[model samples]
Target: LHPAQDIPNARGTALIAKVKKPYTEDPASPVRERQSVGIYADWLPAPASFGDYDQFEGIARIPGQISWRFTMHQVQEDAPSWFGGSPWTGKFDEISSELTVNTLVEVRPFNSKTKKAGQAVLQGTLQRCRG
Candidate 1:
């Protein structure tokens, strides 16, 4: 069975992860809180150079697998004025515990010089943090 097969409403939830191998790899944690699926200003900073974010994209079940995807211009010049994605982009597989984070940041205004942009794929995973 898959890792999150037993998790209730597992899709689209914010998870707390840890750095398994510095910035290059942020291994998945375990299933933890599901209600905190929004922005947390004082949350724990990610130990990776990929940099953390103001919010997390909730996981979603795709055609054959589960995935969480987010982008400002998944199309082209489509994003609004004051709304968009985070600085870090990552993937989490609850079953395999394989979370890969790829950061391609472009903060609003469609294309801005202040935005640090690049699709640098860093490897990692996701799970609940153990206290």
Candidate 2:
């Protein structure tokens, strides 16, 4: 069953951290880093059934049409220093450049091994490739 079926009132994006290239001792090439992405929403209604989780799944057979997308870098654990300051350690322009929103995502629910009730998590593997 779809995650939405279990959580009708759910709303939120998935914060993903994509490691482009593994940092190794090889210094020939510049270290390739995965740029962070961010997805924004005015408000994310709490999940109906899933505790502390929101839906992030979309219909199958679509590309780049995620139900919700979020870049972990976009989410700041600490508040910005100033009103216009960057959430991350970069210039305002750099921070703004890292934001990205994907409309394709899907989530599913199943019995939680740890929790007493069922759990909701992402359905598919989300990955990013760096060239």
Q: Pick by TM-score: which candidate is best?
A: 2
lDDT of 2 at 89: 15
Model 1 is weakest, by summed lDDT over 10 consecutive residues, at 35-44
lDDT of 2 at 70: 24
For candidate 1, write residues 44-76 as lDDT tens digits. Answer: 122122343322232322324444433321212
Q: Which ten residues in a row have the lowest lDDT in candidate 2?
A: 87-96
Residue 63 alpha-carbon offset, candidate 1, angstroms = 12
Pick the lDDT winner.
Answer: 2
Give each model's whole-structure lDDT.
Answer: 0.27, 0.31
RMSD of each: 17.2, 11.5
Stretches off by above 4 angstroms in model 2 are 1-3, 6-8, 16-22, 25-30, 35-103, 110-131
Clashes of 2: 16
